[model samples]
Target: MVEIIDVDAENVDKYGFFCMRSKPNSDGYQKKLNWVKERLKEGLKIKIIQENGRQKGFIEYIPGEFTWRAINAKEYMVIHCFWIVGKGQGRGFGSQLLNGCIDEAKQLGLSGVALVTSEQGWLPNKKFFERKGFKMVDKIDEFELMALSFNENSKPQFYDWNESAKEYKEGITVFKSDQCPYIQDAVRNIIEASKDLSISVQIVDMDSYDVAQKKSPTPFGVFTVIYNGEIITYHPETKNRFIKMINKKNLLTNS
Candidate 1:
């Protein structure tokens, strides 16, 4: 039996978000819980999919005007996360969740439902959105902005991230938000890795949607690592991975 439940601020504690379900006490989970609470007021929605009384997956989205991604999608609904894992795969649960979100967007008179997809890991892949009739409207690096528009001419596009990158031309800078449950660990590892290399690092928190839309160097928006003015990674990496990445770029000299 497949069932979908709507999670709101009032019941989010009772029905935890899909990620970190086993580690609710972790900093990442608690931070995400608080973040979700604030985003709920901005028209964010989370729906969980269950199969035979077990949680299988969840989908999270918000009105585009309030989105944390680097996009100008004021009249659209932007999906932040979508996952169907374990036994939920190949069972049409993903489509079910997407269709529900689409229906809600249509009901709200939004232009479309937008999503950021990638060929890399973390975000969903573009093929899934393509199968559901979404089209790529913009591309930056490995990330693609896709949308299924109700009005043919209306589409979402990414911001001019080049200008944003120019602002962090020196040293290692990490931009992060609480939108993802795993970013806390990633940021912590980044700090530790930089310390080991005897490098100075700056941490910028995307405390508001305005800051995120204007300054996030990539569509992922939640976590980004910039080394010497260029975006290195859009998602989190382990301490060792960070060390190797910096070394590979020759950003630091081996004394």
Candidate 2:
């Protein structure tokens, strides 16, 4: 059974499913746990599934401040991030988590919920949002935009994100590759951590790095935060430091 718990970031040292693979005391592993805990404080809403009283799987949802036009800003829940761990697989646990999200949204009086997912091959589509009754409302390049509007009237109205809103002063641009799940998870965590910040996230496919660099001159790294089109941080695969980078970036831009 999946039970929603009000967990503090500190308890993950023992209860965090994310750190089970490696000894938590190891320096690098401890860093990862700290990162998860920090991000959790930034709008991270978590739920865990227990099988025979052991955590078989868990999901995390980060709610952010950005408003989606789903049934107006008055009634919409934007799912900034959600994840189900590897141990939590093959038991229909994912679907249960999704249902829980729906029920939670309904309880909150949200007209609907909106999220972004890969179009099949980009990520495991089946495990993403397919069975949750989410439908493709639009597609931009390889990324697919989806929504599950509880109230039919709550459909999302989107427009071309203002690519020209304002040029970032200057920073590093870290191009993220899909091959690294840890990097992806880091990105997810930071995005969640950035819930109330005045920042923008652009998902780029590293496959087009050379082309993107030629298209625009900037430092290219993976799973990183950018400030004015410059790379602020780069890691081969680590979830920590992203939020700190993002917080710093936002300050620079908003200043």
Report, for every candidate in turn, its global Cα lDDT versus the true structure: 0.90, 0.50
- The runs of at least 3 residues in candidate 2 whose Cα sits more than 4 Å from the true structure, single-residue gaps closed, are 1-6, 17-43, 52-54, 64-75, 80-88, 119-128, 157-172, 175-181, 184-255
Worst 10 residues of 1 by lDDT: 246-255
Across residues 146-165, which tens digit of lDDT does each residue of candidate 2 receive?
67877886565334432421
Best candidate according to TM-score: 1
Model 2 lowest lDDT segment of ten: 64-73
TM-score of each: 0.96, 0.52
> Residue-pair clashes per candidate, as listed?
0, 9
Candidate 1 lDDT over 1-255, as tens digits, reads 889989998899989888998999999999999999998999999999998879988899999999988889998999989999977799999999999999999999999999898877599887888999999998877878999999988888998886577678787999999999899999999999999998889999998998898888787788889988877887788999999998887745445
**Pairs with backbone N, CA or C atoms under 3 Å apart (clashes), candidate 2:** 168-228, 171-230, 171-231, 172-230, 172-231, 173-230, 173-231, 174-221, 175-221
Which candidate number has the best lDDT? 1
RMSD of each: 1.8, 12.0
Regions of model 1 farther than 4 Å from truth: 251-255
Compared to the true structure, candidate 2 yields what TM-score? 0.52
